[model samples]
Target: MDGEPRTNPDVPRVDDVETWTHSGLQAFLQALFFVLIVRPFVLLFLGLRIRDRGRIPAGRRPFILIANHSSHLDTACLLNLFPIRRLRHLRPVAAADYFERNPFVSKLTRTLFHILPIDRTARRKDASGQTGADPRQRMLAALQAGQSLILFPEGTRGNANEVTRFRSGIAWLAQAMPEVPIVPIYLANLGRALPKGHFVPIPLFVEVRVGEPLLPRGDREEIRAALESAVKKLKDTP
Candidate 1:
């Protein structure tokens, strides 16, 4: 979700998102942030719940977890959905322009979440007419290093009431990293709490529904369709 959603229009737009910070201290700080900030934030507002957690394999095995994107809360909600065993290795894929646009946000997103940045401004092809390297390469490398990812393939926040068609980049990533499985997630009512404009969240009771993992199918369109269907199936889950 091409980069992070414009949670508020007042934030600045910056250049590329950097990944040069990963230290033990950063990891510790991330843990604290999750507990001190993220945990309380979600608990106080969202009636967040995860379903079908058993479908996801246990241990440190890396898998791409894709979810519907509506508000900035989607990121936080997804992060809290996993158990402690998997949360340590899960990284959110955010848009560079939104999060990296300011010094404060860049530090928070990079140091705490260790997010993978996608160049939202990139053209479809480079000057030579060949496709440029995907932003998900960083995500793929993270997976190779035993880290999992939370991705929103709609590439942008959609209306909370409906899901948009997913971009095919997810399929390519799945094909390239076939060793990792793909998990589909459905988020409901997140957008109503904080859609595109409002900075202060409205304290809505959001729901998180996790689906079973799907092995990467090489066909991009087919994979996208299946993922969409899977997410739709969980959209109305209790």
Candidate 2:
């Protein structure tokens, strides 16, 4: 069924909407200080470099920026390269299991960044028991609200800079929000800077190239293949 609503049995429904109330400015300031001030210093000290930042469009629109995930630093590196004015409208779709593991990270992700929780495991059924909270639905809702999202289609980080096969969720999202552009991003040298295990990033020059926006066409499988191919081409670029 197209545009059908699905509920995940595992996702606990909150009785009150107030439970999701956002944090105040003071709280945001404190969080921003750490994210903007301390984090950048560390990254800079590690000789982090970003290239092709001009490719990212500077405007307000419901869009999705898809990239290859390589390390924990992926999100931070993207945020660092993202335009400052556009930050407020962009939300990153993060894994619930990883981000929600700690209270502080969860609050920061939910309040400051407006991240949406995605279920990685396919076993959990949605409220209708048909499908879980499809990441595409969340992306559509964000788009309908005139907000943008950041997604890593590979699902997880790999060892090399090569692009992994994209999951079908991205295709589904593109199909649902045909008007929204899907921006492909390539972050070079991130894998070596900070691989999967290492918490601390070594001094390494990183390049982020934002390619042309992708519009959906054909079936879900076809779109998925296109998105994967686009990402691979972005990675291949010098």
lDDT per residue for candidate 1 within 47-73, as digits (tens), equals 676677677766778888899999988
For model 2, give the 10-residue run with minimal summed lDDT: 12-21
User: Deviation in angstroms for 28 in model 2?
Assistant: 3.3
Q: What clash count goes with each model?
A: 3, 5
Per-residue lDDT for 123-218 in model 2, tens only? 344543655555556556666767778899988888755787898888888888788888898878888888998888677777777888878799
Best by lDDT: 1
| lDDT, residue 73, candidate 1 | 87
Error of 2 at 131 (Å): 8.2
List of clashing residue pairs for candidate 2:
7-126, 7-127, 8-126, 8-127, 46-203
RMSD to true structure for each model, in Å: 6.0, 5.1
Residue 88: error of model 1 in Å?
4.0
Among residues 3 or more apart in sequence or in different chains, the pairs in candidate 1 whose N, CA or C atoms overlap within 3 Å are: 2-155, 3-95, 4-95
Candidate 2, position 127, lDDT: 49
